[model samples]
Target: MRAVIQRARDAKVTVQGEVVGEIRDGFVILLGVTHDDTIEDAEYLANKIVHLRVFEDENEKMNLSLKDVGGDILSISQFTLYGDTRKGRRPNFMQAARPEQANTLYEQFNNLIKNEGINIATGEFGAMMDVTLTNVGPVTLILDSKEK
Candidate 1:
């Protein structure tokens, strides 16, 4: 499992011109699941994201976690994160999990985040989505279960 976490002042996801999910003063998470990902991976990534100290503190230093600032999360499924372009002009997604498995893990990841006692919003899994966000401090971080 992997996630690209961006601190945002606000974020929303739209599908077919209908807003599916939205949040304010939170994280815009682009989540990816791989063939090897399991519930454990989902849990780990969720925990790390919520506890990550990317928000600023009293002295303008980045020291406040999402939990500390009472923030929400907007999670979006993005299997393309696994795309490999090392071979040629085209990218391969062989490392990404099948839709069935990916969807299950994606749901699990979102549920885990919700269970963390924070508000959570999500984009439709496997759907074409348009995501909008006002990135805060332009703070972005990548989390991968394999790296931990």
Candidate 2:
């Protein structure tokens, strides 16, 4: 499992010109699943992301967690994060999990976050989505379960 977390002042996802999910004062999460990912991987990431202290305090120090600031999450399933482009003109998706497995883990990941009492808005899984966001602080971080 991998997550690309972006701090966003506001964000939205649209499919076929219809807004499916939206949030304000939150993180836009692009989540990916690999073949070997398990519930434990999803659990680790959900715990980390909710507790990540990247928000600023009164002294302008980054010391506030998303839970501390009452933030939401816009979660999107992104299989392309695992695209391997090492030796070919075309990116290879062999590292990405199959759709069924990916979707199962993806949903479980979202549920784990939700269990923490944070609001979650999600893009339709496997859909062609257009995402828009105002990336607050332009702060972006990538996390991989395999690396931990």
Best by lDDT: 2
Task: For model 2, state the Cα shift of residue 37 in Å.
Answer: 0.4
Per-residue C-alpha lDDT of model 1 across residues 13-40, encoded as one tens digit per residue: 9999999999999999999999999999
Query: Against the true structure, what is each candidate's TM-score?
Result: 0.98, 0.99
Count steric clashes of candidate 2.
0
Model number with the top TM-score: 2
After TM-score superposition, what is the CA distance of residue 59 in candidate 2 from its true location, in Å? 0.6
| lDDT of model number 2 | 0.97
**Model 2, 63-102: lDDT tens per residue?**
9999999999999999999999998699999999999999
Per-prediction backbone clash count: 0, 0
Q: What is the C-alpha RMSD of each candidate to the true structure, in Å?
A: 0.7, 0.5
Worst lDDT 10-window in candidate 1: 135-144
Task: Give candidate 1's error at residue 4 in angstroms.
Answer: 0.4
